[model samples]
Target: MPVDSTGHAIVAEGLRKRYGGTEALAGFDLAVPKGTVCGLLGPNGAGKTTAVRVLTTLLRPDAGRAEVAGFDVVRQAARARYHVGLVGQHAALDEVLSGRQNLVMFGRLYHLGLARARRRADELLERFGLADTGAKPVKQYSGGMRRRLDLAAGLILAPSVLFLDEPTTGLDPRGRNEVWEAVGSLVAAGTTVLLTTQYLEEADRLAAKICVVDSGRVIAEGTPGELKGAIGGDRVDVVLRAADEIPAAMAIIGRVTGGEPESDPDTRRVGAPVRERVAALTEVVRALDEAGIVAEDITLRRPSLDEVFLRLTGHRTDERAGERAAEEVAA
Candidate 1:
């Protein structure tokens, strides 16, 4: 597809990369619309980091093409570099430098004049909510403060595209929210963002579109709600009064819902998929009543992103060892 001239911030096609014996990326493709946020999510070792590296020009792709901010990632790498900002998983701040000094240092690296660099540093200190701590050494800053400062450093050039790789890995709930708020503000002001995160909740809340990667390939892509809808309809959960009655409950639920019923051996709970939640609930309760099965609890809810991931990959995000082995082979 041709790149859009108006606001196509990033376009990548068939991007491939290898690290010695391992293949970090295998024909990966991505297109990020300008002025929007796209969340890249997958289990550990899913080639997310490798893809980001290639797009940001940190690592070269063996084959394929990519453009960032209208500049080719390979032939015009320097131009691409100037239009992008990266906030990596680790804080890239110098512990000995004060927050204000760190920002100023990055501004100078971006080739800003000394006077302009100092003015930008002051502006960022306030924007990132670090105005009061600007003079403090980074070593004395809290984890959240350091993270904010690191992000401020990336924004020194005011690049059109920003890449955030697990920006809130170890932060508290409040700290995470602060970062999320900043990201939201940036998007609102027309900055394109490509964010990779393991947190499903983070993707669900912030991503305009989500791309699920596994084994260095794009397995699925869609809006959060669209992916959930594709997994089927609402879930009807029935809790039995007696543990021994699980088998009996499952049989009745299957017949009533006309769908496969899954049972938990320990809790005597059964769940089935249903097209209509209210109708399914009513039918399940009446059927159980007729079968002489007592239901202790009943609830209906939509499928979560966790379930969606499992249904698509047959494994959850927390299944690390298997993913690592797959990644090693792909890499």
Candidate 2:
């Protein structure tokens, strides 16, 4: 049955693809709403890149169906390609070309006329905050600047759907921040983006929704907060001034949180999942004060994405998800 793609910028249903014995994508399904960023997260060999390839019309799927920008990826590949842009793990700019020249070249390649290309080049340079340094060769640009230029090139056609495969793989914190701002601006302007990244922090920051892929299928999907809350809602922890207070502290915390409390004598810490985080913390503190249990520290915190990924996928996100070429080739 065909799934309606009326309001989705990207849709995939039971999408399957195999490379020899490797099942790159097995019954994968996804739906990304229009004008939003959908983060695709997976460990290596999890079919993240293969799915992107099929959705962007780069590779044909062996089975199932997908649609991008309201066009069937298989039956209407050309139309889908026209309305989409792709930025891979690495920068695709020519080092010798100035940022302005590179964007102009991209515009021309997209078949814009010389005048139109030049105009578009200037427009992108200004839009990405590269206008002041547009004349500098890409080789002279900083890592962040080069990435911003790559992003600008991807937008040369003003694509309605953009696929980013780890757009900040090697960038330092500052460079990554710059690219993050650029991506935010694109979504603000109504472009739908599908971002595949290993950086949980990146997805947590940029994606309105996240899908966790494992074994070539989506094992989990939700907003960052929702996903984090899935494992355990919120936790209250207390570090007692004396390790001997563990038993008493656990009883107090368990009563307030209404959950079993665990204690670590070595760390002098007692922790438990809490329903009402602030209120529970307050109640626990008052209880401890009345019991004359000296407390060194008390805090409430939610589960991190890393913990969620581990709990769901049974492994942490490999930092080496960058080796896509080999993975896709095997796929």
Tens digits of per-residue lDDT, candidate 2, 76-147, equal 998787899998888899999999999999899889999999999999999889999999999999999988
Candidate 2 accuracy as TM-score = 0.80
Instruction: Extract clashing residue pairs from model 2.
Output: none
Score residue 154 of candidate 1 by CA lDDT. 83
Give RMSD to native, each candidate: 5.1, 5.7
Q: Name the regions of candidate 2 deviating beyond 4 angstroms.
A: 19-21, 233-254, 259-302, 313-331
lDDT (10s digit) by residue, model 1, range 1-331: 6656466788888888888887778889888888888998876678999999888898889999889999988899998888999999988999999999999999998999999999999999999999999999999998788888888988998889999998987777777788888888888888899999876667877899989887787888899777665666567888889989888888888888887888887877899878777888999999899889998899886554455567788776565633442332222
Model 2 weakest lDDT span, ten residues long: 322-331
Q: Model 1, residue 318: what's the lDDT?
A: 61
